[model samples]
Target: MRLIIAEKHSVGQAIAQAVGGHMEKHDGYVQVGDDLVTWAQGHLVDLAAPDEYKDHDWDRWSLDTLPIDPTPDWQWKVSRDKGADRQYKVVAGLMRRGDVDMLVDACDPDREGEAIFRRIVKHAGVSKPMRRLWVASLEEDAIRDALASMKDETEYQGLADSAMIRAKADWLIGMNASRAYSLVYNARFTVGRVQTPTLAMIVDRDRQIAGHVARPYWKVVAPMGGWKLAGERLDKREDAETLLRIVNSDDFAFSIFKAERKQQHDAPPRLYDLTGLQKDMSRLHGLTAARTLSALQSLYEKKLATYPRTDSQYITHDDLDTLRGLTEGDRLAAGFIEPDAKPERPHLELTVNDAKVAGHTAILPTMQADKAALDELGDDERLVLTRVVRRMWEAVGDDYVHDVTNVVANIDPHWCEKHPDEGRLLPEGECRFTSRSDQPVSLGWHAIEHAAPQEDHGEEDEAAGNIIPANLAAGVSIAPVPHGGATLSEGKTKPPKPFTEATLLAAMEHASRWVEDKDLKAALDDDESHSGGIGTPATRADVIEKLIRTGYVERKGKQLRSTEQGRSLIDVVAPKLKDVAVF
Candidate 1:
């Protein structure tokens, strides 16, 4: 008998369906054709914690065990989670069967996915001819194709080795560092390879916000018809009033000394990767990053979407026809595409850089782009699916078009970078006052945004207030009404805004910015490096959620702030452990 073991139950079901086998449901598996198919709930086994080690010294919490490394004889056991033991027994039983000819690793196609399958097989102590079934998409055709081309598991040795090393390294850092800090502070401070650096970033930002003291400043605005032009800010009110008086004089005229008008275009947003989707979910629906991942996991399990853990925002050439058909068939999304929108050369060519794709393509809908499928989803799942569908349509759609204009008024070119008398003498001349305005030439891909069930960008555009009539030209003299909404205004300098979940996720993703050394920065910023960032996309949400769970961080509205305990941990923790650059 040929036995197939998938990473999850839903995947197992999909495989059975794709192969068209009669079903005989068994203990923790099902039978289709002559194949007995089973699933493991994520990982059935994990490396034993420090307490489970043989020596009592390890069990004791002290400074002597500052760094723990797993030896060659390190132990593994069934996870303590509820159903792990039961599922482990079932999978092991199936693998040990006399009739089973070979074992198939039908797990996820990434490093962590490789780790999940290998650990289970090793723990069960079942040796057989191992085959790999790697599928990027869960569509019936894709699954059948993957099965027909299954390769020996030996091909993934490098990926498995990398995954093992990462898991052990994280365990060593977390186990020793957490205990050392916890003992030193007399509190169970959870320290980790990624979580520490991520928490430090938030704490540093909070310090800046706390240290800030607001200062006052002044600005002058001139109202002309429907448009408003603001002069540069002045340190004092007298300086602002002096400029206001000059402009308020009877003979003074507003002339645009410089003007530029050009056509501008915006391509649709890149497709959803795990991090991008998490950021959008946090901002739009107030869902935590962990919650968003969980929702996406459900979608992936039901085969409604492609793999959710992929980092690549690009697809390969093989996915072109699948994506183009999806856009054409989706009724709600079809209108977003232009009548002339053909999946022709350049536009379809944009998403097909083979060098950028790895493991899996971008998150996309399977046959589930069908409008009828969305009816059974919950509200949060519904929102996520809607966005996924909308993004697909937008990716291949036309570029949005805009007409932009820049108007500069009351110019004196020599005033800037010109101090004629060696920083001392004569009268300083008036300076240029500039403003920008944009007119929408065409909606293009953005035409469907109004009809999609997506969130509005929470803030109005900063430059939206400056738009003017199309007929306004350079060198035209316009009368100024300085009294209405355009009078002199005074305000206080504000502190930097706190870090919200969406912004925090972005910071964590681009964690290379936290370090300054050129070589180290390169190491972190290289997206190709599997372990480049502080945490993997698969684990970043958990790292963030763990910080909150352990009292190292707290949520205020949408902002994530360091608590008193969290702040003190940073203050007292050893620099080598908490330092973002080194850690």
Candidate 2:
């Protein structure tokens, strides 16, 4: 008999179905064939809190307990999750059974996933033969594939080590800093590896906004028939007024300046990764990051989409055939017609780059998805899945096309005779104009539309327009218009916007920028060796939520802001921990 331990109940059930195990209800597991399918509801055990140690001095918060480093003899406590204690006992009982030959840690394929299994097994004192059942998706096919190709547990020792380091570092920081700050300021505060840096980003942005100052400037405008020409005045408003007086002399003659036209292309957008999907859902549908993730996970469970919690924007070469099948006969493939002679080779390159991927491939649609099944999903879930399917089709489809044009003019000084003080220089019919056209071109992947009003912009402007009008050589001239009005507008500089979950996630992923060692920062991004970065995708969201719950950070609309207590805690920490280094 083999005991398969899963990260959660849903995952265990999926694995059991894949392995063709019979259903027998035990206290905390479902028996199938010779396998005992059981799961941990996240984590069955966590480090004991200070007060749980039964020390009166540690019962109340104090700065004196500055750095509470737990020794090997430190106690472990059962997790507070509703049914964890019972679940742990069930797992232990299975491990102790004489017939069980080996144990399988079938958790999510990430660092935290390793931590979940290791903690449970360590606490249960099970030393049986062990292996890892690493599957990127919860789909039965994916699970079966993983089981058939199971790797030895030792293969992931580095991952386990990294996971342990992250957990201990977080424990050290969160326990010590939280207690220290809460005691000093008489407020509840929490800090950790990911959350503290995140809070610092928000506080800094707030300070930048508070300190910003505004200045005034002016510009000059000339109108010619249907077109308008504008130029900035020197820094002083008086200089602009003086120029207006000179140009109003009625003897000034305008000369042809310059005209140029250039062709431009806007490629279609890249496929969605977890962060990209979250940002799009938030911007388009007003869904929170947590809600978007939940919907995506549901889509994956139903076998309609690939893995959801991924950072990679590229797929493996092995997935090409599956991708090709999705693009054939799909509703999203409607407008694309395969070439008659040799279907133009699909542009699989954009989604197939091997070097940039980490952990798993980009979020995509599985070939098994049925369009009719969409009716069974809730409104938001259906919307998000539809987006995923559409993106997959677009990624492999043709590029978008566009053409551009530019026009320029020169005006006579006599045009400004009536407005000496206003800087209005062009008369009704005294301006020369020129026009030119550049060739039309394709924008590649950026042309594929992801949502309705296909050309809509996202919050961060990842693919904002950069089209330049066609150029007409410097001396070209055309018909001119007689008169136009000129006016100056005034505005002040604004502060940086607060961190949204989307922006904050990006900051955390790039947190190594704050480190000083180039080598350490490089190592942080070395996915093949380390676990990508400081926190795994499965744990980052929880880290963020913990920060909010502990009052170290607060949400203002969609933006995150650091509270007063959070700011003071950073000041109290040693400079090495707080400073932004290259590592």
Candidate 3:
């Protein structure tokens, strides 16, 4: 008999259903025709704590036990999380079953999933022939297909090695640095490889906002008949007045030196990876990353969505047919699409890039979503499901088309040279003004976005020049209007906005942008898995939550700011410890 171990109970249940047997359910496991299926509650086994090592007295948090390196002699312990130990025993017992000859690692298809299965096997001291069950969806067909074409567990040894190395590295850094800092400061301080750098980013941004100095400037705004022309910025009010006067003067001759309009097409957005979904949820729904993840996880278990922890934003060519099916029929009408809504012919291939999709495809609504009573889902789940479903249609929708017009007018050189303030405020050359406008021809994919509910960020309106007259032709003479012409608009340069959850997630995902060392930045860029980031899409939200839980970062409304303690921690940590490139 073969034993299949899954990452969670729901996954194991789904696998058992796909396996198709009598399905005799037991405590912590299920009995299929000729196989046993079980699960681990997250990490059933973890790194042994420092105090657990018999070779050292590291239990007493002291500076002497500074570098807690359990190198070649690393130890493992069962997790104390509720029910983890019990579940581990059940899985271990099944592994040693007399009839079982082979084991299947049916964990989530990712690096962390590999680590979870390996740790459980090692801690249980079981060495049976193993196979890997890798699938992105929990749907019956997907699971059965993955089961029939399993690969030898040894084929994934390299992935397992990398996972182990990352776990140990995190342990070493977190244990030693957290203890050393806590001892010196006489307080409990928790440090992590990725979490520290993440905190540093927040602290740095806060400092920038606190120390920022605003500068004032002025611009000349002239109201044409149906358009507005903006002049170059001037440092002094006198200079602005001189240019404003030149444009408004009776002798001033206004003529369009250039006017051009070009058609542009904006492609639809790519599908959501986990981080992208979390970011959008945080922005539009005011949901935290953890909350978004939890809701998605629930949806995945219910077989309404595909995998929720993936980082890839693309679907493989193999999923093209599935994508096509989703766009047709009543699949999206469950709760998101209106009956009268006429979606465009979806360009299904737009999001298909096999090379970009790694272990799993981007999150998609399962066909089951169509039959599910989505209204019964929790508010958060419904909100996320709606977003996912809407994005499904939008991802394959038509491109947005718009006509952009740019116009530039030059002030007659004779008038500039003849002005009273000739060489003073006015430059030697001809004074020029510019205008731009965009006329959207097709809403396209944006139509779907517009149909969904959006959070009012209270964003300011577009500049006046964004809608100038399209009829203005090159070399056309113009006369300035009476009121609101030649207006001197004073503005102040604003400081950087505080980090919202959405922006912070973006920063963490693209951490290489924060690195100064070229070599290190290049290395990060070349990393295929992380793609120049400190944490995976799976762990970043947790890191942020940990910082908040520890009182290091505080959330004021939607903005995240480092508290006094958080800033002080960043200040005290050594440069190497907080460096983004190093981690």
Residue 240 of model 1 has an lDDT of 71
Q: Pick the candidate with the highest lDDT.
A: 3
- Give one digit per residue, the lDDT tens place, for model 3 in 1-583: 9999999999999999999969898999999999899999999999999999988998988787788888899999999999988898999998888888999999989898999999988887888899999988889998999999999999999889989988998999999999888889987888899999999999999999999888877888787766677776667778777777767777776667899889999998899999999999998889999999999999999888999989888898889988887778876864586544436577888889888777888999887786355877999999898889888887888888988888888775555567656535667332678777777898888777665555443323223336767567897777677633578888776677899999999899888888988977777776364463888888888999999999999999999999998988898889988888888
Clashing pairs in 3: none
All candidates in order of lDDT, best leading: 3, 1, 2
Q: In angstroms, give how far residue 111 of model 2 lies from its true place.
A: 1.1
| TM-score-sorted candidate list, best first | 3, 1, 2
lDDT, model 3, position 287:
96
RMSD of each: 3.9, 5.5, 2.3
lDDT of each: 0.77, 0.66, 0.84
Clashing pairs in 1: none
Backbone collision tally, model 1: 0
TM-score (all chains, Cα) for each model: 0.91, 0.82, 0.94
Q: What is the lDDT of candidate 1?
A: 0.77
Which parts of model 1 are misplaced by more than 4 Å?
A: 332-346, 411-430, 450-462, 469-486, 530-532
Highest-TM-score candidate: 3
